[model samples]
Target chain A: MPRSVRVRLFATARLAVGRAVLPWPVPEHGLRARELVAALEQAYPRLAPTLRGSRFLRNDRYLRDLDETLRPGDEFAVHPPYGGG
Target chain B: MAVRLTRRPLTLAEAERRLRARPGGAVVVFAGRVRRDRRRGSSVVALEYEVDRVPALARLRALERAARRRFGASELVLWHRLGRVRVGEVAVVVGATCPHRVEAFDAARYLIDELKTTVPIWKEERGRPVRRPPRRRARPGVRSAGSGRAP
Candidate 1:
């Protein structure tokens, strides 16, 4: 099986991407979180705006900063600001 | 359960019941309902709520613990509806039971405030075009929100 990151989109991000999840390809050596996000924006221009105001998670845990590295098979989730009552 | 994220309508009655009244305990429940507000020149018919269940429930449980520690709450109910909530329908309920009224109210308030700011929940507005009389009327129907059911 090929190495890939599972990118989960929610709410506005889902709307922008037209899907809830994506198999984002990444090098086997892994890459910085920032690089992955930039690549996504380049691939899906409509997602750029939503990405600007979103929080990132890896394996259900929030990323402290974009410096964190994303390895193959990691689940990356994008959460926009909450609006629930 | 101290917290819930469900597709069914949330209710203060259920929340109060979950608290299980005590002889001297005071309960304070805050229920938030959907409103028929206007947006983009259209009337909002319903709000479509979505959630990232794993993180959302974790945060709710965390808030439950915080409420108990901060306000001396003996019991709590934090329930939120997922999916299409029609106008005037209850969308969320957060309540607490404490030995006194002050602590109960404070705990309830804190849960709601924290839940809104921290939970992985979001809502999108579904609108109905305002009828201008001359224009053809839309069919009297609405689609369910996402994969969740509508009431």
Candidate 2:
């Protein structure tokens, strides 16, 4: 079976993609976070601008490095600048 | 219990009560309310707040620990309201209790600032559409220049 990752979008990212969640395909060995983001940008060109300003999360944890590998069935989230108080 | 992301209303009284649980010489509480701001000729009626629950809670907990370690906070309250919050409603309540007034104030400030910049929460304003003035109709027998009526 083909490996996949769950791409979660929040706030502006969700608005740009018009959905809260997306299933993104990946290789069995998974791909680097940078490559996954690039694939997402290619798939949703409108989301490129939002992606540039967003922070990434891997399975509910903030990712400080984009080089981190994302394995199959992992949940990756795109969070725009926070506006909470 | 100190860190919360609720969907219900947040009250200053509740936050104060929570902070009072710990005996401290100084307790500071800050409440953030949704304002009816004007935007593009429209008025903001409410703010819709959304969050990625698991991560938001995790970050809040981390912030709580940091506040305690850095500010010597004996007690802390970092409650934030989710969903649609109307104008003038309390959107968030942050409080800190410390042995001294300075630490309490600083801790409270830090809590709110960090929450805004670090938490995984977002708010979108919902505004009322701008109302335009009704156009005046040319009265009968009133000769308007643009109506092609000779003056």
Candidate 3:
């Protein structure tokens, strides 16, 4: 059986924290970071507006698209524009 | 006091004190301040700074580590102040302690230069561009991501 992937969010992404862990179902071979975001938005309609305006990161680096396949133990995040001081 | 970010006021003396060590031979300090330009009045208005802390800290730690490895410096300090700062107030301060003048000076300059292009901090011009679409402010130690450097 394929192991379930763990996703972590920070800053703006943490808004979907109604539950500590969401049982994210992944594709048989796993999905990319962007696809995970799409699935997350579908599951949590309340976060739709924020989902449109956010950028996603797999690990600490920014991901260019949603189709990048997720690897086991890969961490994901959604970030909002933070003003730089 | 040292190697930290603060939302309150920045004190130069405190920064120097933090960087100065008993056995270190030299201490270097660099303070970035607000200056009046033609766009503003004779007196400068307040300067506001915003930062994305997560990425900012990541880059800061990277830069500091690089400096330490390349220079073999004894110690280093970084302080950044946010919110309404008046003219001549310190925005960012960097201090390095080393055994000689050359390493201290070189590391300090490198840190400041990298900061301007990389650290993900933005500035507001205050008077102009207020009504325009919210633009991303320029940050130290950062480039547009295709420059091929670590910004």
Candidate 4:
């Protein structure tokens, strides 16, 4: 069975993707954050620009390195620039 | 709680009440309100605020801890309102109580500034179109009531 990771989008990312969450299929060994994002952009052309200006979080923790691996069932969040006050 | 991401309205009075309970010598409160800004030709009627709750709450708590540690603040209130907030409504309140006025002010400023840049919250403005009354239509074969020459 192919492993699946939960991809979550927020703010502008959410707007671009038109959905808050997506179940992404990955390899059994999982894939790097960078690869996952590239795949997402390929899948959703409209989301590419937003992803360029976004930050990534893996399971509630900020993913400072795109090289970080995302395992199955993990939650990956795409955060656009914050506008809170 | 010192850190809050609620859907309810925010108030400076409530923030003051929370911070004043601490034994600090100085307390400062700052409230941010939605403004009726003009976008293009439309007027802003409200702001719809959204948040990625889990991460936002975590960031808020982290900010609260940092404010206390860095400024020696004894009490703090960091509240942000979610959902639709009308113009002039309080959207956020950040306050801190510290041993001195400088620390209190600095902490309050830092809290709000960091929250703006770091928290996973966003606002989209909702605009209303300018209204104009409809023009009166002329009736066929009807005489005007105020006309000097009757028909």
Best by lDDT: 2
Off by over 4 Å in 2: B134-151
lDDT, candidate 4, B1-151, per-residue tens? 8988888887787888989998999999999999987657789988899998999999999999999999999999999999999999999999999999999999999999999999999998898886658856669878656756656
Point out the worst 10-residue segment of candidate 2 chain B by lDDT.
Answer: B142-151
Tens digit per residue, CA lDDT, model 3, B34-108: 776655333346677756567678878888898888877778877787667777788888878888889999988
DockQ of candidate 4 is 0.71
The TM-score obtained for chain B by all candidates, in the order given, is 0.83, 0.87, 0.77, 0.85
lDDT, candidate 2, residue B31?
96
The model with the greater TM-score, 2 or 3, is 2
TM-score of each: 0.88, 0.90, 0.58, 0.88
Off by over 4 Å in 3: A1-60, A63-85, B40-44, B128-151
Our tally of clashes for model 3 stands at 23
For model 4, the superposed segments whose C-alpha errors exceed 4 Å read: B131-151
Candidates 1 onward: DockQ, in order: 0.82, 0.88, 0.16, 0.71
lDDT of 1 by residue, A1-85 (tens): 5488899999999999899999988786787899999999999999999899999999999999999998888899999889998
B7-97, model 1: which lDDT tens digit per residue?
A: 9877777787878654337988899999988757799999999999999988899899899899888889999999999999999999888
Residue-by-residue lDDT tens digits, candidate 3, A1-78: 435566654334455555424546676677777677777888778666767877666666667877788776666655
lDDT of 4 by residue, A1-85 (tens): 3388899987778888889999999897779999999999999999999999898999989998999998988999999999987
Clashing pairs in 1: none
Please provide, for model 2 over B50-124, each residue's C-alpha lDDT reduced to its tens digit, 9 standing for 90 to 100: 999999998999999999999999999999999999999999999999999999999999999999999999999
